[model samples]
Target: MNYETFAPHPNLDAIVKCHWILEVPGDMEAPKQRVIPDGCIEMCFILGDDVKRFNSENEFIIQPRAMVFGQITKPYFVKPTGYVNTFAVRFYPYGFANFITQPIHELADKETPLTSLFEESSIKELEQKIIEAASTKSRIAIIESFLLSRLTDKSIIDNIVTSTIDSLSQTKGSASINSILKDDLSKRRNLERKFSKQVGISPKQLGRIIRLQAALKMMLNKPGENLTQVAYENEYYDQAHFTKDFKEFTGVNPKQYLDNDQMMLSSLIYSKD
Candidate 1:
């Protein structure tokens, strides 16, 4: 497996999180990767064997070649159907709203094709262009060009959302929803409505995911860190409560998560972005 990450262009700081490329061979077997709840959305271009998202024991959905995965509200599972090769864009929670017109929330549980959100012919060309633009400038310019040309609604770029995001990042996703909204209840409510409509999940839920994300990275990076401390550090209720949330997000106990055969995809924000 080979993984690479790149920083976003300064101009796209609002909508773009970062760019990444991942490659894993087909012969190698990996554990089913758990898809946790994250505050953000993703757009990916598959360069190899397809991936499968299981809806049930027997039901699954295949990802399209060029797809934008909307904000996920609940946990899900993904396993590569064959060798996995992909390049993707990780967007902030509110980012996709600027580029996509169709309510992203409606795509909560599925991998909808780009054509559904954009013009069919344009999507084909855009996909090719993004893949072809490997350099940082080229990639950033492509994303910016898409928004500037296709998404002319200047009002979608919001200052309040950016301010809230700044504070949210500083706290490592542990900020209180009430505190975050205390000063502007109306603005918070409006954000909630817009978030649900555009991002597919509530702000509070995204915050929890963010906190879990922080804890997951800490636990992974600092192997010696104890669970009780991890829980307390992330502001969970208690050790048991913390374990429960971790298991819910990961589908495995914290102690067992790393050892699992599945390569679960928790929020990789801390590591990549």
Candidate 2:
């Protein structure tokens, strides 16, 4: 398995987080990998064989070849059908809304093909370019060109949403909406409405995901760190509180996360982030 991320173009640095690529050999026996919410949206192009997202023990669906997967609230499982080669754009929590008119909340917890969001002809052309690009660098150039063309003054994300996200991120998701808004109840209500539409999840949900991500980084990087220390460092109420939230999102506690073979993919991705 090989996974890597690249910086976005300077002009798109604010909204676009990074462009990533992943490749795994076809001959390897791949297991069902668990994917958890990371408080972000992704636009992906599957450049190799198909992938399956499981809905239940016996049910699964093939992910779109060129698609935008919305904000995920909980963990899900995916397995490669064969070789895995994918190129994707990781957008900030509020970033994807700046390029589409659809209500972002409507896209949560599932993958929507690009044709549904943009013109069919244009999407086809863009997907072709990405698939045929000679290298990852060329693919990044193609996607950036498409994104820059779609971006417009009217599509700019709301300032309140961006600033609030900044505050949450800076505090590692510990900051409350009231504190960020200086206890302005009216503004809190307004922000909640816009945040759901623009980010596909509530402010509090995103905060929790962000905080979980911080804890995950620590656990993966510092293998010797205990749960109690990890919880305190990330501002969880206590180890029990931390374990509850961890299980909610990951379907497993921190100790299991480190030892679970199924977490191989998620661990690789989170460690890099």
Candidate 3:
């Protein structure tokens, strides 16, 4: 398994997290290469063999070679068909919301083709151009161009949504729903309705997942650090609380996560962030 991440253009620094390229050669089982739950949406283009995302029953189903995965609410698995080569654009926590208008949560637990979501013939051409680009510069240019087209109306971002996003960024995903919702208690139910339509998962759920990424990074950065201390520093109620959140997101305990020799796709992405 080989992974690489490219820095975003200066103009897009606030929205795009980064553009990354991941290539897994044939016979690379990628068994422990788990995609931990993170509150970010990603667009992937497969240049090689088929890949499958398992269902709750562990059933494998073919996913489109080109698709977008919205903020994952839970841990999920991906195994390459053979010699998988994927070029993906990983958006910031709120990045994907800028592109699609329908329910973001529908992207969960399945692969939705770029054709169905972006729908624009131009959008399809942009993805193809990116995948075919010989140099990273060309790929970046393609996405940057697309973003420039979409940002024509920066004012389209609504007040309620942007404020909640500001709250999340301010807390680094550590803030709770009750605290963030204090601004507009009456909008609580309406907020989620908009979130489901625009942001994918509810804001609270996205915050929790984002917080897990933070905690995981703290642990991975200092592999030999004390787990309980790490938990406290991350604001978990206790070691038990930390452990539960960790398992819920990565489907593995911190201790086991530390000792495991296999590379974690999610952790790799988080560390870069």
Candidate 4:
């Protein structure tokens, strides 16, 4: 398995987290990869065989070759049918909302085909262009052009939502939303409404996911650290609280997550910038 991420053009830095590519060698077995919530959204294009997204213990459907994966609250599994080559655009919590007209919350926890989000003819044209691109650089250019063209009103970003998320991220989700908005208590309801519309999740939910990512990064980077210490450093109330949240989003205990093959993909992605 190979994964790499590239920074977006300077003008899009605030809107796009990064552009990434993943490939699973045809000669190797394609293992089921578990993906957890990270308070972001993604637009993915599969350039190889179709992948399966599990909806239940024994049920799944082939994911569309071109689709958008919305804000996920729980962990999910995906496995390639064969060789896998994919190019994806990852957007920050409030980034993708600028490109679409609907309330972002409506897209949570599911994959929506690109045709549903854009004109069918345009989506079809974009997919063909991406597939025909001769190199990764060409693909990146194609995707950026499409995104630039679809960009909606950039003024839609709310200052409250932006500052709240910045605080949550800076503190690694340790900052309480109330404290972040203590200056104007009356704006809490407005904050919730803005977050739901632009971030696709409540501020609290996004904070939890961001906090989990912080913990995961610590665990991955410092393999020698113990869970008790990890929980303390990350500001969890206790070891149990940390473990419970870890399991809730990752579908496994911290101990099992260490060096677990199923978690390799997610671990690699998080371990890097």
Best by lDDT: 2
Model 3, position 169: C-alpha lDDT score: 66
**Model 3 lDDT per residue over 55-152, tens place:** 75477778787788777776777777788778878877556767667766778755678888765697668877977899767877887887767765
lDDT of 3: 0.75
lDDT of model 1, residue 135? 65
List of clashing residue pairs for candidate 1: 31-262
**Can you tell me which runs of candidate 4 are displaced by over 4 Å?**
none
User: Which segments of candidate 2 are over 4 A away from where they belong?
Assistant: none
| lDDT per residue as tens, model 4, 166-219 | 999999998898899986778988999999999999999999999999999999
Q: Which stretches of candidate 3 lie over 4 Å from their true place?
A: 27-29, 56-58, 261-263
List model 1 lDDT by residue over 1-273, tens digit each: 777777776767767777777788899877667776667788888877889888876688887989988877666888888888787888887778878676767877678798888899988888889778766467657766775576566577566666666667778777876687777677878887777765678767777778888888888788779899999998888989888877776677888876665643443434444
Error of 4 at 26 (Å): 2.2
Q: How close is candidate 1 to the true structure, as a TM-score?
A: 0.88
lDDT of 2 by residue, 64-158 (tens): 99999999999999999999999999999999998988789999999999999999999999999998899999999999999999888644589
Score every model by TM-score: 0.88, 0.98, 0.87, 0.97
Candidates arranged by TM-score, highest first:
2, 4, 1, 3
Candidates 1 and 4, the one with greater TM-score: 4
Question: How high is the lDDT of residue 143 in model 1?
Answer: 60
Superior candidate under lDDT, 2 versus 4: 2
The better candidate by lDDT, 3 or 4, is 4
